[model samples]
Each structure stands twice: as C-alpha cells, then as structure tokens.
Target: MTRKPTSSDHIVDEKFEPWERNGRMPLPVVWVAVALAIWGTGTLLTTSGGAPETAVEAAVQQDRPVDAPDSGAALFAANCATCHQPNGSGVRLAVPPLRGSEFPAQGPELVANVLLRGIDGPIRVDGHDYDGHMPSFSAAFGDAEIAELASYVAATFGDRDDGVDTATVADLRARAVGQGTWSGGEALAAAYPGLPPQPAFSSASVTPVSADVSALIFEGRDDVWACASCHGDLGQGVENTPRLSGLSADYIAKQLRDFQTGTRANEHMSFVAKGLTEADIAGLGAYYAGLSVPSTAAPILGGDLKRGETLALVGDWDLGVPACFSCHGPSGFGVAPNFPALSAQQAPYTASQLAAWAGGHRANSPLSLMDQISKGLSTDDRRAVADYLASLPAVPAGSTGAVAKEGDGHDL
Candidate 1:
C-alpha cells in the first residue's frame, strides 16, 4: 500500500565501496600542498622588501631560495644542514662533525673528490668513530657547483682561505669516473697521506681503476659493478628486482636517469646510477632491452586467483580501479615504448611497487597514473593483481600470449 519506509527498512547497496569511507588526502598531495604554502608565504615576505619581522620570514630568508643566497651556503643549507647542524656540529654518534675538523682541511682536491664521489664506512673525527653513508652528488651538481660547495665547506668548516677551482673539480671528476662511493675516510687519508688518520675497516683500500676497461658497457667498469650481478644475466630479475629484458631502451634509460637525479629513490640503484654516465646509461638500456628471457618468477603471494583475474581484466569500477590490461595492453604484453610488460614480473616486486606508489615513495609515473591508481587499491587488491600478472605467460615484447610476429617496434 505505498507506505512511507521506516529507517530500519533501508537496504545497503551490494556494491558499497569500503575505500570510500576514508577521506584522507594522498601523502604526496599533502607534501605538495605544504611546499606551496611555504613558497607562497616566502614570496609574500620577499616582496615586502623589509627585514623579516617573524620567525617564518627569517627561516625563509636563511633556508628558502629568496633573493638567491650565496651558492655554497645555499647548497649546504639545503643538503647538509639537516644532518650536520647549521653550525656544522653533526648528530652524535651518527654524522661526524665538520666544523673545526681537520677532515675537510686536507686539500681542495680531496674535498672536491669527496663531494664528487661520496664516502661511507667507519670514520674517526676528533677521537669519535662514526659510520655513515654519504651519497654521491655528482649527478646533482656540475663541476662548478661542486667546486663552490667544496670551497665553501673548506672555508666554513676547515677554516681554509684557499678556495677550490672549477677546473680542478672538473679534472678530479674526470679521473673519478667509474669509481663508486669511497670505502672510508681512512682510504682517502691513505691515498693522500697529508690527511689525518682514522681507524677504518682493514678490508677498505682504494685501487683506482680506469673506466675504459669494460669490454661491454653492460659488464660495467672499475668499481662500477656489472648490472648482471644483481639483475639476472638475461635481465630476468630476481625477487624484489624488476625484469628489464623486454622493456624499451628509452624506458630503461629514463629510469636510470631518474635514479641518478634522485627522482626515484633506491639506495643501491641510486649509487650505481650515479656512477653511470650518459653513454653508460644508453648502452646499458640497449643491452638490457635486447635480452630475452623466459620468466623464472612464480606467484608466491597466495592471492585469490579469481579475484586477481577479475581485477586484471574487468577492474572494480566501484573502487575506481581500472583494469590492469587497459593500459598494459591485451594479455599484459605491454604497449612498447611507454607501458611496461607485467605478464611475467615477480609478484613481490609488483606488489612492492604498488605500495611504493601508494605511499608516495615513488612518483615517477606518467601523469601520476600509478600513484593515483595505487592509492585506490587495497593491499589485498595489489597482491591479487600482482600474482595474477605473475601467473601470465612471459613473452617477447612483440609477442602476445602464444602469438609471435614482428613490426610491433619491439621485435625481439
């Protein structure tokens, strides 16, 4: 009889999305917002053309790039001040002190080399032993900038008046090619006996190696280890590592460049990528792309296969997640020069990548597609799709499923 329905008579939709209950902004978006706010505030302060009246204004003057401060001081403030305090008194038992230390006082060449090629392992400064890894800034800075940074550190911390020159830095950089992070400060001290001694690992020693020794660039040169050592010889990849065999050379080179620039963060990859020059990146990319390997990876994540299959092919429109194959290509064979083949990827690697995107650890995807899509996926959803992709047959870039042909631009 068409009576008004009571509150208890209401029914929930069968397609109700659990993810919609949360209203949190993605972490990356939040960071971007904060950065914008700081910039805006700094801009307002700078336009006033008066001494900073507030603490925020003062911070903006010292820390922000307002008025473009001295290059060396600015570089140190942005990069080094976080660990080594603004005064150069470092974190206790972690990063060693730089102020009044004899370390940087060694020589302009030594300081410049340290900046060009990082240092790590145990080091003693004024009777305190500190073990810390310093990343290479070579990729981030040109010879002139590095010279400025080195000269600044020496004058400020080592109390030296002799400044490093750009030519000296350029020459040192050329000689340091193919050398990975320095073993320790001790190694440097031994290499330049004029420097102060610090206890170091007995195994730590420096033997300068030329970059020209590699028969194949993919095999690496000098202290730069071979790509095949970690990624399989055929680029099949092992566990958390990604498969590079069927990827486009352009994509591979782009990723290495991103790693070098710290756009994508992976300690091991960044270290290795920093050591690679443009030619090395191009050669390695081509070398890996040319390789063809049967997928050795298997689904070990114990995800629901039916759910995974549905997600990979059909997608959950309610949760705003698109089918994996819509962009990856039919049968997940990949769309060549852009999208990567996911069919035979290791489940662990795939799931980790999805998590990284969702957590804002990775932001390199085109138009932030992966970051957006990953945010909508639950952990179970990620594992399900990863396992499903891993279960698919691995094929060459031009081949889809059981089919084999050519002229797809990824002919292997």
Candidate 2:
C-alpha cells in the first residue's frame, strides 16, 4: 500500500540551482559567459577613438595652483593637442612638433610671448618647417592658465620640468602691452641661439586666410564646429543646410535667437548658436545681407518642378493650403522683414525644412503658416514645391529684392 501511494511524494529542493549541479557553472552557462566576454573585448577594441578628453575633465584638472599639476595633462589635451598633437609629434608643414624640440625648452618667456601674440610664417621644429598660422590665445586664456599649458608642453613633450611659473606669467602679462602677431622666426632664432637646431621641412608654405570674424562663419565657431561644413560659403545652402544669405536680417536674428533660447529644438543649430554673442549675431546678419544670392548645384532630389510650380503659385485650397507665393511674395523672393527668401533654395533643404515643420520639430516659422502648409501637403507635393523652388534663379537680372519688407494680405 505504501509503495503504491508514492505518486505525489517527489518533493523538489527549494534552494536547488540547475547551474550548480556540479561545483561550477554548467557548460552552457560557461559558453554564454565566454561569448559575452569575447563580445565585450571586441566592443572595447572598436571603441578606442572617442575623445582625447572632455571639457569637464579639463576644468577639474585646474584645481592645483603651483606648477602644471596632474590636471595640465587634460588641459593640454583639450587645447594644444589639436595642432601640436597629443604626443606633440605635430603635423607635417602645417604645425611644428613640440616633442624633442627646443621651442618649449627656450624658457617660459618665449612660450608666453608666442601664446599671447600668436606666431606666424615659417618656423623650424625638430628639423622640419611649419608655415601655419597659430591663433593668439591671449584673448582666450589667462596668465596662470597659459603658464600651466606651457609647463605641460615642456614637461610632457620636451621632457623638461619647471618651465613657467604662474607668477612669472603674471609678470610677463604686466609687461605685455600692445598686440601684434609675430611675423617670422628670425627674431626668435637670433634671440635664442641656445635652442636646439631644427631641420627645415620641404613643403609648400600654407597661404594665410582671413580669420578675423567672418572666417568663423566658414571655418568654425570653435575647433569642433563650422557653419560652412553644413551651409556652404556665401550662405548657399548645402545638402540639408538652409539658405541663410539674403534672408531678412530680422528673420535671421529671430531664428538665431530662437535657437539660442531653445524655442527651436535643433541639436546642431542650437549648439553653434549658443556661443554666438548679440554683436556676433548682428555682424553675421550684416555680412550675409550684403552678399548677392549665389547659385547652388542642380537638384538631386527628383520631383516634377512643373507640378511643384503649381503648388508654389496656387495651393490646393481644397485642402486648405495657401499658395506658397502668397506669403513668400510674387517672385518667391520673400517680403522684407520677417519672411525668408525661398528663390534658389536647395531642394533637399527645402523638403527637410517642410518635413520638420509638418512634424512639429520646427514651429518657429512666422504665424505657424509653415506648419499649416507643410502638414496639408502630401509627401509628393512637398517634393514638387521644393524642386520648383530650387529651380528658380537665385538672383534674377531684374530683381534685386531678396530682403523682405513688412507688408501683408494681398492674396493673388
């Protein structure tokens, strides 16, 4: 009877682990772990090239006072490393090397001067010549900070200790008066004969480019960004860059202000706009406003301009969308004041902006007209109008009216 009643007698162990059946993990678990480890190793190998250092890390390193502290390593990586390179090997015929070079060893005085004034023209370093321009750090860095940078360059690259003290830098700053960029290395070479003999590099000397303020628009806002990288020079819109030139100054100003204020939600434009000052904004407006509209490349976006023209001239009122020209003006040149010029816009840029408006990503357009118009159009309609706009002559022979003027409500 007892043997026959044992159907429900098999109790499972509460603390049992299938993986610990033996003394170690099961073979399958081990295999899974090995696969994970291999994957992790591969990930690390692939991700060895992000940033040399971040700004937060550089700021943190500045806690020390006396010499170039352990923090200078981060500071140097942030600033000097771009041209002289992280290891100070530098770039050929562009920038001179600091590694094993006599430049950094010529005492902190010379280094401080160069830092304050900026050096240009042919310079020899490690038996090579670099004819590149070095922008002045005087406007950017303070005495203690520049000293720390110089100290780091000498110790880390020149392999020397105790280059420039902060006090010495302050003293030099006091003596430093009017600003003029250094012309060549002749004066430096004559002054510091004890410096190491550097071999001259044989390469074409780089021509100087205008870098005052306008260059920032084309070159970079800082080392990490450039408007020209997206928008072409003269504000000709690139692939997805909106045409910036010939827009009403007020329109451009408002857009930049919106971008800065987070009223606009573009990651790229906002980032660049954040660093621009009010004065900078005004100057840029003037610069671009003065330029005549430049022609862009042919439309790569395939759309029927004829169909697009219909959308531009007369909208489908059946769908409650207004003619594109109704607000843009008869010539699509934009009414001066708030509206932007649409003539000769890039097709891709036009389409993208329209799409952004429709999706509610761009709500900064005047009167919410763009949002309404974009949402009403089908994708094909959007493409058609964008292509049609791109085909218009940027600057018509008889039309010099790219700037918008304040007036409204003459529906054609």
Candidate 3:
C-alpha cells in the first residue's frame, strides 16, 4: 500500500525553507503572548466600560449616602483636642488658650487663615505674649475639609455666623498665596502707625557698685533665673523680647535701673527686676555682658531648609510677604532697645508670637502693618518660615560691630 523506494516520497529537504521550518513553541513564549493579549483586552474593556468592577466602586455604589454630621464639638474633639486640650484651656506659658480668645471670635477669614497657614513668633493675645508656633493643615486638608474646620471653629469657639463656605475658603487661600508669610506683632507696630502702643515694663532702680560686687550676687544661688529668662537664655529673642546677652555693662545696668524706677513697665520683668538690689543688678549685667553670644538652635517648624533660607533673604512675591532681613537685619542679630535677635531663638516660640499678633492677643506697637501681615499667613507658611529662621547660624559677638566689654551694657 506504501511506495518506499521513491526519493520524492521520502521526507528529505537539503535546502531548508523558512516557511517549511518546524519547531516546538516554547511554553514561556506562548504564556507571554497570551498574557499580553489578555492585558490588551482588559485595557480595551476598561476603556469601553465593560471592565471588571473594582472593590472601591462596587462598595461605593452599594453604600448608603451619608451626610457629614454638623457637630463642631465632635470635630474639635477629634482634631484639635490633643494640643488645644478638651476644654481649650491650653498649656501654661506654652500653647495658648483658644477658648474666649479674640482670634477665634474675630472673623471667619482670620480663622480660616490661621487654620490654613498656622502661626509663628511672639504673638500677643489679650496683652500676654505667647512665644510658640502652630503647625499647618493645608497639606492634610482639601478645600472641603478646610471649610468644615472653619465652619466648626466659627460655630463653636468663635461668634456664630452663617458659617464658612467653600468659596470663602478658596478666596482666603488665594489671598494667602498672595500675602506670603506674616511677621510678629512687634514688627507690625514698627511698620504701621495708628496701632496700639506696646505695654510698658517696670524698671529696676538699682545702681552698679562694681563687677566684683556683681559676681557676689550669684555666689550662694546654684541656679536661679538670670537676666536671660524673659530676655532669652542666649539673649536672642524671637520678637518683642529684647536681646541682652552681648550688650555693654552700661546698657545692661541702665535697663535694670530703668525697670526698678518704674521708668519701664513690663509687668513680668518689672516684678522680677524690682526684687533685685542695686548691687545685684550690677553683677547680673556684668555676667551677661561677659558671656559670649550662643548660636541659634535648629528649626522645629516643617519646611525645606534651603527653601526657607531663600524666603528669609529674598521673600516670596507670590505670597506678598517681605524679606525677613529687611527688618530683622542680615544676620538676624537685632538692633538694640526694640529689635530682638532672632538668630538663636526657638522655632515654636517664634511661631506662637506670630499667631498672637494675628489674633490680636498682643498689641502695643505703633505699626498696623503687622496686623495686616499676620492676617495673610496660613499655618503651613508660618511653620516653614519659622523653620528657616531657626536654621540660621548664630551671629557671633561683635559681629554687628559692637565690642564686648564689662559695664558696657552691649553684650546681648
């Protein structure tokens, strides 16, 4: 039935043709092709609205439509209770009280700005200065979330209004972007007129005898509060507070004597200075004047260190904020009598002061610009700006061309 002798019948081809080649397709290769085809089909199906359902969409479709609750108390408890405390009393000399604060009761715009931008530096509230920083909520929240927060604060802590809407939040955000960062209350007083005057501190009336006698005052006491308490341990203040660490002894003694005689009327300092004897004042002044100016600590506020540096020096036009060096000096080693040294101050302390000014807690300066400036900040901006300030190196003594000398009162 089979012809085996025929050469043509024998399956032998000396010249192989590409079309006649026979080989097994690799399992891996076949699998890869099938996978690619399936992927392409899935993509097409998805685009065509015939794709398989995702867990999220299916759940959303099946779930009941629930409205967000209108409970400010609940929202505050959930979000702000941790730092502000449940009763809003706040920490002593640390985080400021939110209850009954003018900031909360002022306007929705301010509240929204505070919530969005946060706060920094020496903020004055009800005549009391709070030197701490508030963190930002912009990154964590959207327009709707910001609206909810503003609405909650307005209804609960602040005077009740129609409530903050999404539009208001958006408007505030736009304005903030135009305004940039805010300066402390003291700076505002200096920049603007028709603002309230700064509160007066009581000055001491003690006369200096000699440096030898001044050193004796601290002999028995291991560590009592020094001239650095209100003036900053390093004599570098964020704002409002004056730097005294690198001043001449004469300047230091003069301030102490002024405080004793009621010439100055700082409530806190007047009380402290009144307790010191004339000899004690001379010794304290000498000690501070003799010490070297310390370096600034690292910034605690959240932001890019490099970016902060740029903003501090050059400022951001998009936000309508000014360069810090314009007023704070290039090295941040503040000038005497009013300007404070910002080089080595704490970041939180700086932030707190800014919030106080914006909220109208502290006011005793001649400038209205600070109020305007503070109104423009968001919480995030405040933190970033403050962090930059904190990152700056300390200005060495005599860096500002002031020589260090005992009884000169120019060491701080």
> In model 2, how large is the Cα lDDT of residue 205?
27
lDDT of 2 by residue, 1-412 (tens): 4566575556657897776656866799999999999998766555644333544466566545746346567767655653466778764443467877787877666777778776654567776654534656776677777787777777776667767877787776766667466655654676578765433333332122335445677677564366667777667777777777656555677778988999888888888889888877776665565454335734568887667877777788997887776677654666655666676778888888888888888886546777877889888888888887776545321122333345642210
lDDT of 1 by residue, 271-319 (tens): 8888878887777766665544457777789887668878877789888
Please give the distance, in angstroms, between residue 359's alpha carbon in candidate 2 and its true position after superposition.
Answer: 1.2
Best candidate according to lDDT: 1
Q: Count the backbone clashes (under 3 Å) in each candidate.
A: 0, 9, 74
Compute the lDDT of residue 180 as modeled in candidate 2.
62
TM-score of 2: 0.46
Which of candidates 1 and 3 reaches a greater lDDT?
A: 1
lDDT of 2 at 89: 74
Instruction: Give TM per candidate.
Output: 0.45, 0.46, 0.37
Off by over 4 Å in 3: 1-225, 228-267, 274-290, 303-307, 401-412
Q: Candidate 2: give its CA RMSD in angstroms.
A: 21.0
What are the per-residue Cα lDDT tens digits for candidate 3 across 293-399? 43345566666655565556667767776666555544454443334445555677666666766787544333554555555666666677667666544443332
